[model samples]
Target chain A: MNIIESITKSDKNISDYKSNLQKISLDKLRVNPIPSSKNEIWRQTNKSKFYRFLDFKFNNDFYYPQIPGNTKNHNICRIIIGENKKIKFKEKKWEIKELEEKEIYNFLEQKIIQSDTTQNWSNLLNHFLTDRKNIIGLNISGKEIPSLEIICNSMTNFLNSKTLLVNIEEETSVSISQINIGDKNSALSISTYFNIGKESVVNHGIISFGNNKSHIINTLNVRQHKNSEYILGSLQYEYDFARLEININQVEGNAKTNIKGIQITKNNEQISTYANISFNGPNGFLDQLNKSLANDKSHSVFEGLIIVPQIAQKTDASQLSRNLLLSNYAKIDTKPQLEIVADDVKCMHGATISQLNEDEVFYMRSRGLTLEEASKLQLRSYYQEIISFLPISKERWDLLALLLKDK
Target chain B: MERKKEIKQPLLEIRDLFASTENLTILKGVNIKINPGEIHAIMGRNGCGKSTLSKIIAGHPSYEITSGQIELCGKDIEPLEPEERAQSGIFLGFQYPIEIPGVSNLEFLRVATNARRKFQKKEELDTFEFEELVKEKLDIVKMDSAFLSRSINQGFSGGEKKRNEILQMALLEPKIAILDETDSGLDIDALRIVASGIKKIANKNSGIILITHYQRLLDEIKPDFVHVMADGKIIKTGDSNLALELEKNGYDWTDEFINKK
Candidate 1:
């Protein structure tokens, strides 16, 4: 399939992008063979379970799932399912557009397509499978914009991918949330790239829920400029198999990055999370916290790495991974890696794996709480640290509460 | 020379209690009776099993009562669970309160209060009414309203944690309150406030059993009887003057007296 010809035939607004995408579509066709368990990065996640679904063709005749009513908040809500996309605004103050123009094409081509998108198989597949009209662009400046929400659903047997490019202009702040809910027997992937301008702030949240027999993958790449701040809070709760990879690069001095994530898996499910943060300038800062809970023979993996180069002096970075194994048969793999080439950087990492505390349970029980009530309280508090970082709307909270369901 | 006369219908009674943990005996044939409107301070040295007695009474799962009977209001509560014992008007103010990272103090108190109320077949308070009730009890410990919003004792100092214990005691209003070493980590000012808080909650229908290592707390809150426990058994029982005598003479006198016997 020629990607450029496919995109050009779908929409006229992106006719100019067809030629540019033509230059990269040939490179996207060179698929990296599916990684095997022998590979170090693929050791924790068994890739054999996903190989049979790799060559699936797009299912265009399936029903486009409707966006549920609970997701319609006071903010700007956009629903994207297959080729049908709709955007509604309650109070419009920000810019929302499609990335079919010249400037966005240049940025996406240079910074994303020609870069390490070649190395990631999911990125390569996304580049080949996704239409250019499926890309959404958001820009916020000089205003307090409400949270922009995107609800994505995949009813196809093959990959249903969407890309979001968000830019926060100098000294502005904005929040974005992307939710993926897919049907069983479908495979989906979503990628988001953030361009944080100087002294601006951006808060991004991604939540993915999949039914049994579903496979999903999500990727986030961020570039932060001088004095900018970026926070990524995510909850990946349900799936038969899922993986989330986040890469953050500090482009200049004094940029900050905060990442918080929670992953819950049960019933033979498997979930993996990878977070890599690099400091390229001096006085950069990063704080990353990730937690996972696995039960009933399930498996959960968390890998966090922070890199500080010599030019990035006085970088402050800390990463901690806390995991809980509910059943004796459950498995959790956590490793926090810190590679520091700078002489003056302050970086530390720690990982802890523990069960529900006996003393804490007894304490609650001594206070008249039954065993079930006590355990429920402890479990709720376990995720409160990350849940509190989510957006404050009732709808968002309800979505966050899904993390604790059936625990 | 004589112990105070026992009131009718004792609140808590332990008859010939013998308990141990993991085959190591801690309490050897301990016996005591506490009645309403009275404060009994059990004074002992380290390893004399004062805390073991408190834990056994509270039904801590770690300890096994080899042979004993623990009765509340003349009914055997030996087979009840810890929460069951608690809902039956027995409160154990922990010597070291555990810090729960995410459970708010307010929510814990509300759950505990409702659990007891439900056990007693009473109506549970709604959120607004429960908040009002908790606010009134907050004054008993002189605590700031901000502490209620925080995780239970997550970052509390030693004194603040002790005050929180007292605040919970005030909220539950248990018929029998057993405070184990509530005076250990307190300064004099905190000691005064905590002692007064205990006093404020103590009433004619409720009894208090205070376990302490010092007579200084006895100076603030006088106990009706001071029992000297050595090697897990009460060797001497006397009036309040026995606490002063023990503070002046120390446990050496008890060892000498036991050696002579």
Candidate 2:
């Protein structure tokens, strides 16, 4: 079926849900008409190749995700194309269930209809394309869950999209991990929205391990309430083409946000991270650290923007991007930007691109380590800061370390 | 054992060595021979090529050996790389040990020890044995067990860094140990402790070369021979009293002595 016809038919067939999935995409398409590579947001990233996958048939029938047998989580969400199945082994403090059609419609009408249209065009496009596909809603209230692992997997030539809405109640704490695994020629997109309640704590990690021929895109939109805290740790490795756009808003005063991300790309892989955090209330704080390693002919791009308005007095935000270029042909483009209209704010941004330290290599060599061993040691250290900050336990770090060693 | 080591052969010998860096000569036709069971103290003023000599022996890549021969255990080792030289039993205690951020001290020690063991064709020590060995060596420097998990010398104080260098010396047990200004920037207590550690590690199978400007370190561990270096060459060689003379009268006598020569 054609892209427009398929989406229009799905919109009609939906039972009682006024799915804005196609409306937003159609509206944006009517306004912008076509995706433009000249746009500032897409300047370093090319989306022309994704147009072909855009018209691919959206299939809702596929095999269940093959998660590792040892993967354990109190709440697990598995998505394949448009189908979703959630298995909850324990549900003491929170409820995990499929979002009703009426609930999904009310959410879109209440949240997206009144938002500024020109701000997040890409996110609107993402939502329009993925809203009616598959969704899982989490209602957490004053409980601490060990971890929730969401596995997204697809085979070759498949098209899939999934969404998650996490409504964290006051004073609740939760940890969530999103792992994306895909085969060649798969096109996967995910959108996760977090409504963090007052005085709540949320720790999230996203590990995207896409194959060499797949295209994956993920968008995270988080709105934090007063005195709430959100920490996000992410790593992306071996993606043919991937983009992660994270938009965080401190809707109330005294909120805290921390983000740590590591991206390792080799060969022809291209990975990009765009994070924009806005402090709307007074005393909102943000700390972001993004480290990327690009080897061979790979390309890594990072753009972090922190906006503190005039009302956000006493805001403290720091954003830093540290990138490593291992080979002569590897490329890294990083921009850490700050827009502070508040006079009483402390804001700092820095970007660094460096190769391995020669002196460090010599020092290790003098201690009898070979050149390769010394290089590996530096790489391991480069990721230690991010890995240590991850909400995962210490015993699980060895698994991540072993995965990094393979690269 | 001492007499046998002394009569057998010199542990390290520099024969008419000439080395330079960036087209500027540093060590000009220098000759020095150090035998096992001997402690040779090389005292020199600033820019006298004392550190250069130690680095050249360690095969630092910045310097060029225009004409020189470094023999370790009666074999020419000038052609080997720095790591090869290290595995061949040459260790240089840097005046400033580099701070390797991110690598823990324990992991660094284990990796270095394993590399040396692999080079020697000896069976590698597993984690348990290596941890025990590192714990034993940590006491030699009076270092706490907490330091094993920290990054290597990332935030260590001057005395602590020196002790870590000595700890590596104890772990590697090189045949020719060149302490290049290892006593610099150390407190009195740290100096005594470091000197004592060096004495404990020095044995009949290894030769120690103490490179320092102050005679205070020698007060703790007396050297059998003292050499005064000036203008890229060793000018005067004497007993331990030479260090006291230089400490009392300064290096002016060496200039006059070189002028007369």
For DockQ, the strongest prediction is 2
Error of 1 at A148 (Å): 0.2
lDDT of 2 by residue, A1-407 (tens): 23444434534444432565556555544455444567656778755545644655565455676654354432343333344445343466665445566776677655555544454555555556564546666666656565666667656787677777777878988787777776777777777789999999999888777765777778889999999999999988777788888999998759999999999888887889999899999999888999999999989999988989999999999999999999999999999899889899999999999999988888888889888888888888898888777765544335356555686
Interface Cα RMSD for all candidates? 0.8, 0.9
Highest lDDT model number: 2
- After superposition, candidate 1 runs with Cα above 4 Å error: A1-31, A52-63, A66-69, A81-83, A86-93, A101-119, A138-142, A156-159, B1-6, B256-261
TM-score of each: 0.90, 0.92
lDDT over C-alpha atoms for residue A399 of model 2: 38
TM-score of 2: 0.92
Q: Give the true-contact fraction for every prediction, in order.
A: 0.80, 0.75
Query: Which candidate's TM-score is highest?
Result: 2
Query: Per-residue lDDT for B46-105 in model 2, tens only?
Result: 999999999899888999899979899999988888888998889989999999889888
The sequence of per-residue lDDT tens digits that candidate 1 reaches over residues A140-247 is 564577676666666646656666676667887777777787677777767777888998888877777677667777878899999999988888876778888888
